[model samples]
Target: MSSISIRKAVLSDLETLLELEQGVIKAERPLDPFLGKGELNYYNIPEMISNKNTHLLVAIVNNEVVASGYVRVENSKIYHKNVKHGYIGFMFVKENFRGQRISNLILDSLKNWAKENSLKELRLDVYSNNTGAIKAYERFGFTKSLVNMRTEI
Candidate 1:
């Protein structure tokens, strides 16, 4: 395994991040027609990187981004009990980079950043169908807390 360096993402990394996000959508949610499309504007690399409440981390191997993840801070009165809660999202690693422990490195960096910012707890929403992600999160001490449901109008 080559040395993997985790670092905070910068504006210069926007293009690479966009490609990685598209790759993840295609790989992880192939059945969804909107996977690689511009359906969810929030995933836009430039916007996400510039968002004050979001922290993006990238894992580089041989000076190339092999994995990435982010934590988005959601300010809401509903989370008053945990005033500084962060929502983890968009975790992805290139297919060839799997099994290299890159994900762990990226996650560790994100957690460290959260700690520095005085965050109390981290939360995320995973599709029930993504068992692999669920298992991975469990390994990092994340457990199922609540199940959310939605209906299309």
Candidate 2:
């Protein structure tokens, strides 16, 4: 076991983050049939790092990035109780680092940032069939809220 540290992501971390992004997509492709085949990206690293509303974070062990996640302030729906909430995404932990609670540390930091910025709630989406991820999120205090359904016409 090695010491793990969490910090705000910087532009210099982009390359490693890109690799982690591929890890996330590869793990998810099997669970999501709607995802396009071939290379795809779910985030803009530079913009995310520069955006005041988003808090991107990375976990490092022995100076190597091993996990990553982010939370962004977003407007709640009109029917929702809160005015704004933190939308979490891009959660990934390298396969070698799995089950070590690195993701929990990232989530803690994101949750604290949301609290400091006055966000009342935090929300995220996970593939319903990704039970492993869902369990992890649930253990971190997230509850299942909504289920989205789709049909191909």
Model 1 weakest lDDT span, ten residues long: 33-42
lDDT, candidate 1, 1-153, per-residue tens: 688898888988888888887776666565343344554434877777888778988888898987889988777467478856888887989988898767777778888888888887888888777788788889988999878666556
**What lDDT score belongs to each candidate, Candidate 1 first?**
0.80, 0.96
Best by lDDT: 2
Candidate 2 lDDT over 36-143, as tens digits, reads 989999899899999999999999999999999999999999999999999999999999999899999999999999999999999999999999999999999999
Q: Which candidate achieves the best TM-score against the true structure? A: 2
Tell me the lDDT of candidate 1: 0.80
- The CA lDDT at 89 in model 2 is 97
Candidate 2: segments with Cα more than 4 A from true spot? none
Given candidate 2, what's the lDDT at residue 127? 98
